[model samples]
Target: MDNSQKRILMAKTGLDGHWRGPTIVARALRDAGFEVIMIGMASTDDIVSAAVDEDVDLVGLNVGGHIDVAIRAIEQVQVARPGLPIFAGGTIPPHAAKQLEALGVEVYPPGSQLVDIVDAAERLTGTR
Candidate 1:
């Protein structure tokens, strides 16, 4: 892991106009020395392609709108790059969070600390 460059693919799985959460997380990931590939308002195809094409170590999604959208993207990413670690954040509802968690995505709802998210990126990508 010391010789590897940890890259993270960050995507928003909806048309939601909010950029604060993902932007902040992206910047924080960058500050932590991760190469963050951001595909804003991305579809499932876009997310999956980037997850593979970008050669990313981890994938982070902003589940802002329909929970199904995030689930679809996560599923595609899993198939495209099986066992790649994924995480998600947003004002997600309890049931939606449960669904994501069931998919093995570390769900971070509103008020989740930046340190925690960045730490997750490190752990997930084995950059710690």
Candidate 2:
């Protein structure tokens, strides 16, 4: 499948008013020819709903506040759509990154290159 056909659902799991990371990632994904759906500062329920309703191929989470919140959202999304590839970015510390990775989510910490993110999107969505 081509990049255009693949959809990525992005959500910020916290009320952290930081939209720069996800915004930049979304723009990169769009420029790379993928459909990027961004639901900024969303609740866990909203995230799961969007993931299911949008039929997205991948989920990009912008985690800021608590890791448990992100964990809850991730678990719900996995149950709602099994095997949906997920990756996360933001002010995640080392411990939280380990937790996320333990749940099979690829983690991109601060200063991760945009090309790497877009490349991961392609690899995860199988659009490469």
Which candidate has the highest TM-score of all? 2
- Cα deviation at 39, candidate 1, in Å, is 1.1
User: What does candidate 1's lDDT look like per residue over 1-128, in tens digits?
Assistant: 54138888888888988899999999888887788888898889999889888998999999889898889899988999999999999879999999999999999999999999988888888777
List candidate 2 segments past 4 Å from native: none
Model 1 misplacement above 4 A: 1-4
RMSD of 1: 1.4
Error of 1 at 4 (Å): 7.9
Clashes found in each candidate (C-alpha, N, C closer than 3 A): 0, 0
TM-score of each: 0.95, 0.98
Task: Estimate the lDDT of model 2.
Answer: 0.96
lDDT of 1: 0.89
Q: List the residue pairs that clash in candidate 2.
A: none
Which digits, one per residue and each the tens of the lDDT, describe model 2 over residues 3-106?
99999999999998978888999999999999999989999999999999999999999999999999999999999999999999999999999999999999
Error of 1 at 30 (Å): 0.7
Candidate 1 at residue 54, lDDT?
Answer: 91
Error of 2 at 38 (Å): 0.8
